[model samples]
Target: MTTYIPQLTLPEQVFASAPASILLPVALGTTVGYSTRPKQTKETYNLIRQPPLRPPPWVFGPVWTVLYGLTGYGAYRGIGLNLTSILPGTMSVARRAATLYTVQLGLNLAWMPLFFGARRPAAAMLDVLALLGANAYLACLFFGTRDGLADPVAGWCWAPYLAWLSFAAYLNAGVGYLNGWDISDATLRRRKAVGKGAQ
Candidate 1:
């Protein structure tokens, strides 16, 4: 008697063979790469932030990890479908959306390096804008792809991404203003409060 190993169909095979963990680093690489600019940037950031907003630093890791998994899977679904007979306009839009999505992720990856590595909040703000723009376009293009069966899942996937980009935009802008304006006085107050256990 021999043990049998079942063969996965093509897409399943791709899904099954691909490790889900790969999404983690790619998602986190965005963070790590962005954070490498200079440690001092984070210092002033901490001083200015003082109390800190945006869901306490500890929460981001788990949240982004889960989000990246969803994002990668959604990407696979949105682009992996056969488009042999789809209209040219839709195809063009879809391709454009896919390109946008790729750019957004690439930008996402680059953002950390710019913000944290180089300590360039202004540059990070620029990158976040691109990410938001690309995601917005992808949402619309994918909207056209929506049908009775696929619309719910595909449309739903982009919602979180849009929300996330929006929040990131705010964060980037806020950081840039605080840093670029050189509000050393305001930062001192917050920094002092932290020392007093005000947070």
Candidate 2:
């Protein structure tokens, strides 16, 4: 006797298979960061001494747009892999990897507000460092070898992000150093007021 299996509808299959749930929120958060671009550009220009390797201000938007797309796609692919896995152990590992991805994404989202909105390079440097750490951890999770469940595509997808963050850490440190970033809130407010007056 043959056992009958229920077939999934197209929408159900797509809903179950696709990673939109994970990617959409990430894309939304990234979009929100664009609102801070003008402030970031102004602050960057006003820097007394930018790092030697700093890219043109215009480069950031395009670069991050590409990077965020890659990141979201990588995450979507990773989650797809997880969702289709058969074993409970595999599912657990995938869930852990997804969680790490979320943590790093949160760090990514926090950096803009700290750096541009608050104009606190020192604090932002700390956030960037933490972001670097999270990226590293997530990369390791994606490339884990001992279990033979490594997702090389997902792991390699983080390469550009990790490289960018390394450069950003250097730039953040340079900005913090050159600007003496330990100033008070009042000083920051006064500087912003003065900057607005000049513009």
Candidate 3:
């Protein structure tokens, strides 16, 4: 009997092998995204009419920290599988998945700014919808059953993120409905005016 291990491509050897390196950028990206919001945004967020199901504000930080870590690990695993696969066409599928993942991350980062910093829940909801779509596509790619790659572990890894996004979509929709602002460019301006008047 003979055992064979697929050789890692140069890129994989340099990048995919170290999960920590992949996770480092994810953590930093999330930190930068969070920092984009003004300090006043937190005060505004706390004052908003959140849905009854909304978790306390403190919950978000811990949840997101765990989610970011899991997502980074999942990405690392998916990329490693693709890079080291002996199977033809695996890398292409993985590349597509990675791209979608990147796009969703961007969308994720954009939501906080749109909702809290810019005070535009409507715009944030749009970003959330796009994020949901990208996340679903990425999850399917990892599951690979339909696509024939079959990496259940990687697929499961994305479960938390998907769940969180779904909850967030509900929250975003609730906020938009409660605030009476959706797709209206004037909403932010109106909010600013009201904030100024109150001050």
Candidate 4:
């Protein structure tokens, strides 16, 4: 494929900048994590039937912080690159790759609410499944496969994220199966009320 060197636009300049790019996802992730009720998240995590090898609750914050940083860096790298030459009206490969990246980021932000805030394991599992699929495609796009743009550095940034998602999938499935896919606060309250009534 021919290399197409195009003028850098304002959007690209902003996203390609290190500080802005790196801070975007990190900030969003942190906000989502905190807004979703951190205390209840930890408490629910403790009460749930977790899979073997699940890390402690404290581990999540740091791990996600690092992952979001990498994600932003990857976006910076990918956005700054000259797009591979392609026909008009079909959308450039770079744009497609960028779009996929954004989609995966949204999926990433959505998981915490699904799993912790709403306490819907089944929905959370589905969201994770979608996140995994979308990210896999995104990784392919960034890595310069026939179906992807040519940016090895961006691809590498997403690799660790993929690995983490694999582990998360296992944990999500395990928790869903072990806990019968029901972990809502209402259910817990109902169970408590039933016990008191029986007494």
Clashes of 2: 0
Expressed as tens digits, the lDDT of each residue in 10-119 for candidate 4 is 25554558788788889999999999989988877877777899999999999999998997888777654533245332236666555666666778889989988888
Quote the positional error of residue 23 for candidate 3 in Å.
2.3
lDDT of 3 by residue, 1-199 (tens): 1111222122344227556635664676568656865455555665565677988777887788778777777777775567567766776666556555655677887888787767788888899999888778777778776553467777787899899999999999997887666423354356556862331
lDDT of 2 by residue, 12-72 (tens): 2321343564345446566766677776446545643566877777787677877776666
Largest lDDT belongs to which candidate?
Answer: 4
Candidate 1 ranges beyond 4 A from true positions = 1-45, 50-52, 83-92, 145-150, 181-199
Top candidate on TM-score is: 4
Model 4 misplacement above 4 A: 1-14, 83-91, 145-147, 189-199
Task: Provide the TM-score for each candidate, comma-separated.
Answer: 0.66, 0.76, 0.79, 0.83
Clashing residue pairs, backbone N/CA/C < 3 A, model 3: none
Q: For model 3, give the 10-residue run with minimal summed lDDT.
A: 1-10
Q: Which lDDT value does model 3 have at 59?
A: 80
Positional deviation of 88 in candidate 1, in angstroms?
5.5
